[model samples]
Structures are given as C-alpha cells and as structure tokens.
Target: MGYLELALQKEKSLLCKRLGHKFKMASPIKTRKENRQVLYQCKICDQEAWLQWPEDSFNKLSENAEKSIA
Candidate 1:
C-alpha cells in the first residue's frame, strides 16, 4: 500500500467495522506520463475508470501494506 492506498484502506476497514459493507472504494492505477497527463486506472472494481494527474510524478510506485478496499 502506498500512502494513498493506506489511507483508502484504513477508511474502508473502518467503514466495514461500522457499517457492514454498505460502501466501497475502487482501486486506482497510475500510468506513465504522456504529454501533460498521468493516467490513473482502477484495477480492483468492475466499473473501470481512468483519472489524470496534473503533472508527472518522479517518485516510483511501491507497495506499503495490504488492506481490503471493500
């Protein structure tokens, strides 16, 4: 889990413990930069969506910890 992932998971776990599967957050994938956009694609959910970052990030992607999104 990256910083974004960690925060998202924490929110999900807390939601589940409190609400019992009433909500969910989709997983997001960020792609390489091109032109001026950085792609963000979700890989964990059925409804796939793409997002764009304002600028390219120099930091490499890494996994922090495992936590269920739903």
Candidate 2:
C-alpha cells in the first residue's frame, strides 16, 4: 500500500486497539486543487477529521482519456 494508506491503517488500528473505536472515511470534498481533502469520522464516537493529500498531484482525467484512445 502507499505511504498515506499505510499511515491511515496504522492510525485506525491504534484507535481500535486503544479506544475500541472504528472509523469510516467520507467522500472527499471536491476542489480544483491537486491536493484533495477528505473527512474521516468515527462510527461509534464523536470524532471527525479532515485530511488532505500530502503532496500536489497532476490531474489524471486527460491522461486517462489519452491512454484509452491509444
């Protein structure tokens, strides 16, 4: 898994083990920026967080379309 995914898993594991809670990630809040923002909320607790990509990323829609036509 990617670094960010691994970190999120580790955080979830820690929360499950320490506080006996579980969380679910919500859909991202769309924006024009490369760094998309998402929210995670606990299923059984009053916890919520906003997370963003660690680095900027180029748009992929055009790239995917080009590849499909090739």
Candidate 3:
C-alpha cells in the first residue's frame, strides 16, 4: 500500500475501534467460487475482506439470526 493508503487505513482502524466497522456486501467474484465466498467492504476504510459464508461468523447478529432460523 502507498503512504496515503496506509494513513487512511490507520485512521479507519481508529474509527472502527471507536464505533465499529460499517461493512457492506461486495459483488461476487466469478473466479473464486470454490467455497461460496462472501466478500465484505468496509464503508469507512474502503477495504475488502473475504469470509466463507457457512463457516465464518460475520458478526454476532448474523450468528443469532442463523441460530433462530435453524
């Protein structure tokens, strides 16, 4: 990452620590379809992260929703 990107990341991290990350669902990647990957982008940082949909808990609310639905 460049200097500006690094600085932005640091600032976003601090903001996340204070208020938590505001994430949104990212578009699907056609190349990576091995395990039903789910991508999330942080609104504050504009960073991308991937997680396995069925295995990973995206957040506490998602976990709770799964439990209730199942």
lDDT of each: 0.30, 0.45, 0.46
Count steric clashes of candidate 1: 3
Best by TM-score: 3
Best by lDDT: 3
Instruction: Rank the candidate models, highest lDDT first.
Output: 3, 2, 1
Clashing pairs in 3: none
Clashing pairs in 1: 1-64, 1-65, 29-41
Model 1 agreement with the true structure over 1-70: per-residue lDDT tens digits: 2222211254333122222332232335344445433233233332222333344232232121113223
True-structure lDDT of candidate 1: 0.30
Clashing pairs in model 2, backbone N/Cα/C closer than 3 A: none
RMSD, each candidate, Å? Answer: 11.3, 8.7, 8.5
Q: What TM-score does candidate 3 get on C-alpha atoms?
A: 0.40
- Candidate 1 error regions (>4 Å): 1-32, 35-45, 56-70
Worst 10 residues of 1 by lDDT: 60-69
Instruction: Report the number of clashing residue pairs per model.
Output: 3, 0, 0
Q: lDDT tens string, model 2, 1-70?
A: 1222313464443243345565555433223344454455566765655555444332353344357668
